[model samples]
Target: MATTNIWQKFKALIPEGSRTIVTITANNGNGTSQAQLRDGSVVTVKGESVQAGLKAFVQGGEIKGTALDLAQYEVEV
Candidate 1:
């Protein structure tokens, strides 16, 4: 018998959220902004220039195959 398994790849770019940890890749202002994770974890990003609309990349996670906001559980950066 041959074991058959299927795997899928998912990718998305999401905006910053309340329970998200974000790092400033590039900031153009005072650079005092920061983010927090849902698990009470934190991460920081420093830069002198930031994009107008900050976004984050998420992947390698299992979804329920439903239409929902995955960013809620993702770290913001």
Candidate 2:
């Protein structure tokens, strides 16, 4: 047996209505923004000197595999 993540489980068990939507709320010129999750969970977005961030919400068939590098700040800006 192999371990599977939520993405993979959803694909195998769910047949419909498994889609999720993402909305990006822009800053009010006050350097504030947020990414609203489907469940209404909010994760604050800090406006870096680059004034950039990434909101990647994935829900689908399979999450092949992933690599995360938080030290070098590569995933999100």
Candidate 3:
């Protein structure tokens, strides 16, 4: 799906300006992948993901744990 569509879906799952931690997993178009985001809560994107001004944010910088699949993520309050 397009980034906009994914972002819209994510927004519907969360509120605006809500403090949250997001984990993204980039799909390699393959079957095998890793899993993360043990928390079931949802989060919001804090910044843009691309130059097109996409409303997508990735989990990194300071947040430590494990890598997550870009396809699957969770928000933790």
Query: When superposed on Cα atoms, how far off is each prediction in RMSD?
Result: 11.9, 13.3, 15.3
Worst 10 residues of 2 by lDDT: 61-70
Task: Flag the better candidate by lDDT, 2 or 3.
Answer: 2
What candidate 2 gets wrong by more than 4 Å, as runs, is: 1-22, 48-77
The C-alpha lDDT values of all candidates are 0.34, 0.41, 0.35
Model 3 alpha-carbon drift over 4 Å, by segment = 1-21, 24-36, 50-77
Q: What ranking emerges by lDDT with the best candidate at the front?
A: 2, 3, 1
Query: Candidate 1's residue-wise lDDT over 1-77, tens digit each?
Result: 97644432222344233232233333336643232334555444343233423443222211111122244455779
TM-score of each: 0.22, 0.26, 0.19
Alpha-carbon deviation at 14 in model 3, angstroms: 31
Between the candidate structures 1 and 3, which one is better when assessed by TM-score? 1
Residue-level lDDT of model 2, residues 11-69, one tens digit each, is 88866534433334443355544545657776544331222233333235211122232
Please report the candidate that would top TM-score against the real structure. 2
Worst 10 residues of 3 by lDDT: 46-55
